[model samples]
Target: MLSMAIGDRIRDFRMAKEPKLTQEQLAESIGIKRSRLAQYEAGRTEPPLTILKMIALALDTTLPELEDEGVPVPRKTKAVQDAPMPNVPQETVDMPYAGLVPADSNWGDPLGTGEELPVDIKFKGENRFVCKVVGDSCYPYLKQGDIAIFEVDPGPSVGTIILAERLGDRACTVKLLEWDAEAGRSRLKPLNEAYEPPSSSPGWQATAKLIGLEFKHEGVKMTAIEPGGFRSRQLAWRGFDI
Candidate 1:
């Protein structure tokens, strides 16, 4: 049976794009009938893997992005001045903080509820959280003393940095996740070449994928920073909105 959540997400994704597409347009782009697309979006029909793939391509997103449990949509920040701000609509979302998870090890509870952090996200869902990094293995990209908010089990796709915990380990690691379907295994590659990569036979459990973190800003303004400044208090990762 098709869940309403999937249907809603399909419709949401279709409408959220710039120059929002109609059902008929999306159907034509995906090589499916408009009625079939409507049925898929209404949860009356479950889309097969092939159709899902076509939909993903038409939407300009990865397949995992479509099937993920929830999407992360960051809220817009307001100015600090007491003066009347512009009448801009903003959305607020809460993400759980799962305490500190190591970047060099594989361990941590993705569902842990140490605290909740409020941020603006593009996708609205309940399966997101933040965790502090305690190691330097992911240095130069993710830094120690920095925080990471992850979208829990948003499925897996190539080139995504993930928060993974081994089945029998007490620690978790943040690294680039890759899957080898033919070998029936998964590999965890670190951004820092100094650290050797690891692989799991049954495949590492993907608890979450690193979204963005809460960083301190000097003032109530959006400042740009280099990619290396992901650890900085700037909202450089805002590009993930795509």
Candidate 2:
């Protein structure tokens, strides 16, 4: 029987690394409400199994690590229990075609094709933005197929993985961010060692910026193809519930 309070353990885990990230940011990463996280941390409420799993994922820990003795059994929400978990990943391809410039199109008069249209995106507090991941840079943590939730004004600090955009590029591939004030530089590192190291060049090289991070939502499991075209892994949701 686990003796520690699961909620306390979770709170400790979150605070251990990201002391600067607000409760709201942590909640967003685990797909929960800020108030709910506060309640859990205060021992006013206990998370259900699904939420527990999401919290574990966000903290980079396992469910067993959050176990506590005398913790009540988790009850599935009525809606979740009634409806089957939606398999949204099946509706789209894992790796989409990139760099489809109009001039390169074999079809004459690409503009007349009427396929490309400009979309007006309205940023709202509740709306979620989907960002397509690129590069094998953050392998084992974030892969090419993963779609990260881009939360504007996330207010991230050091050691956080953010979605930064460069000049003429939509966004950057995922990388761990580190700020060095003494050197007047920010270091972007990959969890995978196979990728090239960050440059020691000058003149604001690479235009690396901090965007939002990939977050998983509880109960939303994504299916992703393995590297060798033989296996698959369920990529869990990594977004916060507003």
Candidate 3:
């Protein structure tokens, strides 16, 4: 009874799909090889709810429909149960001290705080990096001790605040970048009135640009994935949100 129940349901569902889904197509979308899917369809092996969950999603169905009648489906971790998952999961990122950011991956290593933090995945980018704002150099936009996000770029546009360093001294500073065309050099200007601007040649390059940072960490609710048995989320990798 169990053998034919799941196998027949899978085949029927696959055949009923609009334009039809082949064994290979269904398998690949669910992250399994075609042959493995074949075994499940052939009733050669019993698929755990984990695999059944993925198949249900791919087929746009529910686990109860796939399960044999009267067969007790034991409740397991949230990984297999139907429940509203929390917005943020456990993630560790190196919220580095507000300071100079480098071009390479030296600062890329995760500074583990061992605390759970939520990061929205849509904002995730390959060149993304974050640093805490140190002083009032760029006050209004980036206050002291504020979290600043930067994207790695060799040459950021002029008039942009950037994480930069002087070539001769290699001294790092967060300042407004300006190009002096006549002098053929770069100027690192401070926004605060009390701070004096620095004059230097285009001997400096921007490690990254200040794209975004958090002024406040109000809980921003994100739309959850499909509503059904155990919805999935794209876990944000070790990163920052600001």
| RMSD, one per candidate, in order | 16.9, 16.5, 20.6
Task: Judge candidate 2 at residue 196 and give its lDDT.
Answer: 73
Q: Which ten residues in a row have the lowest lDDT in candidate 2?
A: 225-234
Q: Candidates ranked by TM-score, best first?
A: 1, 3, 2
Question: Which candidate achieves the best lDDT against the true structure?
Answer: 1
Give the TM-scores of the predictions, in the order they appear.
0.45, 0.33, 0.40
lDDT of 2 by residue, 82-185 (tens): 32223323233222112221111232221133332211122112222344454444544554435444333233455555434332323234456667788886
Q: Would you give me the overall lDDT of model 3?
A: 0.53
The numbered model that scores best in TM-score is 1
Q: For model 1, what is the C-alpha lDDT against the true structure?
A: 0.59
lDDT by residue for model 1 over 1-242, one digit each (tens)? 44566777788877766556799999987678999999888998888887886676566454566777576421223232321221221464666767776644444555665677655443235676767765446644554445566777646665577777766654577877766688777667876566788655445566677665443221232212121212212322321331
Predicted structure 2: lDDT: 0.43
lDDT scores of the candidates, listed in order: 0.59, 0.43, 0.53
How many clashes would you count in candidate 3? 4
Query: What lDDT is reached at residue 149 by model 2?
Result: 42
Candidate 2 local Cα displacement, residue 46, angstroms: 52
Model 2 stretches with alpha carbons more than 4 Å out: 1-128, 167-171, 181-185, 200-242
